[model samples]
Target: MSSRKSILEAIKAIPREEKPLPDLPDFGISGELEEGFTQSILGNKGEVLEKSVFENWLATQDFSKILSLTESYRNLSTIELPKDPHELSTLDLAILEGQFGVAENGAIWLDDSQLFLRAIPFITEHLVIVLDRKNLVPTLHQAYQRIGDAHSGFGLFVAGPSKTADIEQSLVIGAHGAKSLRVVWK
Candidate 1:
């Protein structure tokens, strides 16, 4: 046998063991989930918009290249989602649907199905997420429980706009991704 085939056969001969998953602690706190979620997002330098206010705000903006995946804002979307991920890099704004929000960290769950193109959120200049107010959870433990068996291959928890303090400890927003993130709660 060739060296590569022998190496593969040797690797396959090794015994495999199955380990039990660790038990996650319950950190569920009782309070207003929306309030906690809003506070956490603010701490991360993100903006929260009420649905009523967002309507008026949306009408005033002039975006050249926009993509909307949410049903509520489909009328406002300028272009269809392109097949190529590379095409998303030039998007000025991308509006997407979020599965749920975690109050403890202000993170929102997004799966591949919701994102027509995975790069739409990160590559755009600005990103907008529409989430139902009732979908807010108290902690990550609860969030993970809620997301169990729901994701399709890929999922992510997006908190706020991209920021980096790698250079001289000075914070820079939009350093690696979207410069602004606006979460509209309905």
Candidate 2:
């Protein structure tokens, strides 16, 4: 046999033992999930907007391109979703709905359901996520439990705008992704 095939066969011949998965411990966090969530968001360099004030503030801006996929702002969808994700390179703003938010880290969950195009959130200059006030969880443990058995092609927890300090240990936001993030709730 060839060296590559022999190597593969030898690897497969190694004996293995089965191991039971460890049980998930119950160590859920307590306190006001909303308050903790807000603090977490601030630490991640993201902001939460009050519904009343957001409406007025949103109307004042003039973004070149805008896309809204949230239920409340569905009427604002302007761009025709393109077949190629690269076509969104110039996207200015993207408003999407987050299924839920994690209080422990201010991470918001989105999948194919909310992110119609995988690149929409990443390519947009500014990202706005709409979440239900009641959907905040105290911790990621609960968040994972809540997502169990759910199915989707793409899923992720977006915490804040893309940031990097690799260049020279200096913080830079939107170096490769959304420049800002704002979460709005009804």
> How large is the C-alpha RMSD of every model relative to the true structure?
3.7, 2.8
Candidate 2 at 31: error in angstroms? 1.8
Residues 76-179 of candidate 1 have per-residue lDDT tens digits of 78888888988777799889999999999899999988896778888999988999999999999898889878638788999999999999999999988899
Give the alpha carbon lDDT tens digit for every residue of 71-119 in model 2: 7987777787788989888888899999999988999999999888898
What TM-score, over all chains together, does every model reach? Answer: 0.84, 0.84
Each model's lDDT: 0.88, 0.88
Model 1, residue 103: what's the lDDT?
92
Model 2 lowest lDDT segment of ten:
24-33
